[model samples]
Target: MPRFFKQPFFAWFSPSPSRLQRRQLRQAIAHIIGDQPSNLDVYQLAVRHTSAAKETKIKGFRESNERLEYLGDAVLGMVIAEYLFKKYPFKDEGFLTEIRSRIVNRESLNGISRKIGLDHLIEYDGQRGRLMPARTSMYGDALEALVGAVYLDKGFNFTRRFILKNLLSHYDLDSIISNNTNFKSRLIEWAQREGKELRFEIISENGSSQYREFIAQLLVNDEPFATGSGYSKKKAEQSAAEKAFEKLELQ
Candidate 1:
């Protein structure tokens, strides 16, 4: 039996067992993964904490999730790219890129992470009680690290299966196509059908280099439709266009 079964277990003790003790725990993860996870080190690397994880480095190097996060990001991109290619055979490169971006975006990754109880796997010294909702990067990054681990341990086929089973299973193809198409592309398509002129322009810039900001204005038929701001020029344009689209009630 595991030491966790020895009684008087700490509430803060690992939610997932240590690597050596994961035969049973990982079995469930395996079913979730559709394969046995052989790289305990890689898994550990995913959930490890770094000084950058917080403001200080009270723990050692192995504690940080950086290395595993790097690996996981690559693995995730590869699997998602492959999936998009197969799923959208007739789609152009730009169209496929849009869908892939939506699937692997931070929001989607975080959603999937929560489903896997990834928060339970992270070990941190920060005050759990006072932590705000926004400081949950560990959960998102850990998911990516897990992907990296899966790729390194089991190879691409297993990783692809895991992605298809757990993550891609939830997305609707048509919905993704409708929602994730670029604002510019979608707007142009609508305009072409309606025979109207549309334009986008950068309005202003704000903030410093470390945190630059952009404001964009959208024009429909040479009149201002909407304005929005974001961390980048492109994002501002997208936001402005989305607002304009909403205002026009054009899907």
Candidate 2:
């Protein structure tokens, strides 16, 4: 548990941060999200990773960013879908969906998080590293959680603007569309051509009942090659394949 949860007096409640610390965090978040928030708790919760999380005594829920991540995923996807629909007026649904997927994927969001310095602000158990494994989407998950906080704090219009101006502005849609490659399909082709035994299997599933997590591991020559996770098997497979694609250097 983090020191913030350790109050000499009321151990059940989180202690208030120092005035200077509060100001610094508020400024940092304002720089990222483009607004000074009225409610700091929501944004603070956005960056708290599960490894450092504390469960509520009554609710039986940890004070982590998972719920916010879920909400933000939907909000971010919808905004991206709407933007693509308008920008590519004559594009087919397939094209729109593919482009949107490329933009909103975990790796893509993680890269953006690094670019925008959001990775620096996330609070997790760094020593034990309980939340980080290879190719973990912690950075992007924090970003999604931040988006959820923005939505809750400032409402949809502000959140949409923040997504467009702060997030999407960092992307080049035309370049992304042209350079897009589906790792799972490419990996499948590589295996077929090289006569290498390749497969993907779901190793685990755990999350809220509304959105179950699927962890998929890629196997090559009957050995585990790489693993990835998502809300669905197909996405988990895709994520695992992406990691495998990088390691295998498949074209």
> TM per model?
0.61, 0.71
Every model's Cα RMSD, please? 9.9, 8.7
Model 2, 1-251: lDDT tens digits are: 22233322112123445676567678978888877888988888888777768678868777889999999999999999999999999999999998998899887888788777776667766565655432578888989999999999999999999999999999988799888477898898889999999989999999889989999999999999999998999999999998997676443
* Candidate 2 residue runs with Cα over 4 Å from true position: 1-16, 131-134, 180-219, 222-251
Q: lDDT at 27 for candidate 1?
A: 58
Worst 10 residues of 1 by lDDT: 1-10
Best by TM-score: 2
Q: Which digits, one per residue and each the tens of the lDDT, describe model 1 over residues 71-181?
A: 888888888898889877998998777778777766667667767655555555454345333444556777887887788888888788888887678767678676654
Cα lDDT, all candidates: 0.69, 0.82
Global Cα lDDT for candidate 1? 0.69
